[model samples]
Target: MKAETVRTTLTIPRELLEATDKAVLEGKAKSRNDFVVQALRRELAAQKREEIDAALAEMASDPDYQAEVLKLEVEFATAQWEALQLGETPK
Candidate 1:
């Protein structure tokens, strides 16, 4: 499917615009819009990764979450032992 695009104007420093033009001429990007879009996508992905990392860090510090994980670990261990005794491997 083709995505819709909107025309927008931005104010950038002269040197930065010059650099972007140079990059476009070098075939690094199809155009200034493409370069900007790629940059935005990369930055958005980076921000999303940081958000996930922060959530994981917060979850690690959560005592209730830790207790639940430990409980599950013990339950799984017992189940695995029972399966082994029955000569069946638990998946």
Candidate 2:
């Protein structure tokens, strides 16, 4: 994989930082940076999923919007299935 490096700073609670360091020493992560990155990624993915589901639910509550969204969902599903058959990952 191609990679690039960047420098950034974060302000975190002292307790949180100490806990993260402990986790690193316990072998939960290669370093404090790795732990924070993995945690942020997981949190972001969960938040996005929650937002999508909330939007779908709101749309479903409206009869007309529900129909349109259902149609789009079907189309998306079909495309995902086709991509899977072609050995591509669908996101």
RMSD of each: 3.6, 8.4
Per residue, candidate 2 scores C-alpha lDDT tens digits across 1-91 of 8668577999999999999999999999999999998899999999999999999888779899978878899879988888778886554
- With a 3 Å backbone cut-off (N, CA, C), the pairs that clash in candidate 1 are none
Candidate 2 collision pairs: none
In model 1, the number of clashes is 0
**After best superposition, candidate 2 residue 20: deviation in angstroms?**
0.2
TM-score, cand. 2: 0.68
At residue 15, give the lDDT of candidate 2.
100
TM-score of each: 0.80, 0.68
lDDT of 1 by residue, 1-91 (tens): 9789999999999999999999999999999999999988999999999999999999999999999999999879988888788886454
Clashes found in each candidate (C-alpha, N, C closer than 3 A): 0, 0
Per-candidate local distance difference test: 0.94, 0.91
State the lDDT at 16 in candidate 1: 92
